[model samples]
Target: MDLSMMIEAVVVLSSGLRLTLTLTILALATGFVISVPLAFVRAFARPALSLSVLAYTYVFRGTPMLVQLFLVYYGLGQIEAVRTSIFWVVLRDPFWCALLTFSLNSAAHTTEILCRGLQSVPKGMTEAAATLGLKRFQIARLVTFPIALRISLPAYGNEVVSMIKGSSLASTVTLLEVTGMARQMVSTTFAPYEIFIVAGAIYLLLTSVVVKAIRFLERHLATDGSRRQRRGSRLAPALPDAGVTTP
Candidate 1:
């Protein structure tokens, strides 16, 4: 491998990093917004509402994101209603289609993560809140969501990293993201090995940042737990064991 050529390839790929980050940020932000309500439905809503969200999550999670991107980008254009509607302007662009697909796919996975967290929240905690005269909404907002969010943080971080890697699929729809730029550079330079390694390194760096950030957040939250345990230990009295007398 020529070191100079590899450096050039890295430079070119860096130019596309903005688009890559754009897709990842927008998709994750939209997905988080969408997942909150759906997760609530899955965790606490009525059967009818929960089942609808379950079906949505099942289909999106079951299918490949690439196929979903294709359907949104190409299939939508084929429909008469889509062609004539105001949304046509948005759907006509590859960027928006990719965003829509990525957002929906991320939302599906995020819903499952958050739903599991919500379900894992101890029933006694909420009951105790109610015993203190907290309203349903107040209990959920104050007691349930805070605990569930802490439980889900690690999984949500994984989802963010996955979306960062998955954003490469945006290349298929003609968006020149990092992987897309690398593919273009390889086609021109006829050196796929060097170009792809650089691309992989960039993704690795991005995921490392995400992992470290999540770990920091986890440790930050753990401090509170440690303090509570210490406080409880200080106030609680020690118990004595009965000694047996032998004849």
Candidate 2:
């Protein structure tokens, strides 16, 4: 590739990086909002509610994000009422549609991750919270969520890394994000390997940042002491009548 092509590719990819980060942050932040409540619901709700969430998770997780993005963008365009309504203003933009799809997709995964964290909590804590006159919501808000979060940090970090990479799919819907710009550069410069390598490097950088952030959170939570006990404790299976006692 010529130096001019390299310069142009850098400029375009830099412009694209902003949209990529925007989509990543918007999806992750909003997905966390959806995930926290859904995690609680999955942990404490009846079988029907839990089953419904399981189904929702299956649909989002099992499908390719590319299909979901198309369904949100082009499928919504097919409705005459949607086209004529105020919602059309937002839906007409691929950016908004991609954001909606990514957010919903991440939410499903985070719900499952946080739900497992909640399950890891020893049963004693919930009963102790109840004896202290804590309401269900209060227990969840003050105690359960914080502990579950600390427990789930590693999994959630993986989700964030996945999210950064997933935002590249937004390019298929006409948003000129990093991967999109890379493809545009490739088409014009006939340097597919160069542009693809650059794009891959950018994704690697993003994933590394996510890993560091999760490590920071792990240290912060460990400062509370309970996390150490939780970490060190062996999760042995229940015994029928062996009379074994945990020290």
Candidate 1 residues 133-235, lDDT tens each?
A: 9999899889998899999999999999999999999999989999999988988999998899899999999999999999999999999899999999999
Error of 1 at 147 (Å): 0.6
Query: Which residue pairs overlap in candidate 1's backbone?
Result: none
Q: Please give the distance, in angstroms, between residue 218's alpha carbon in candidate 2 and its true position after superposition.
A: 1.3
Off by over 4 Å in 1: 228-247
lDDT of 2 by residue, 73-151 (tens): 9999999999999999999988899999999999999999999999998788888999999998898888888878888
Give the best candidate by TM-score: 1
> All candidates' TM-scores?
0.92, 0.86
- Scored by lDDT, model 2 comes in at 0.88
Query: What's model 2's lDDT at 123?
Result: 80
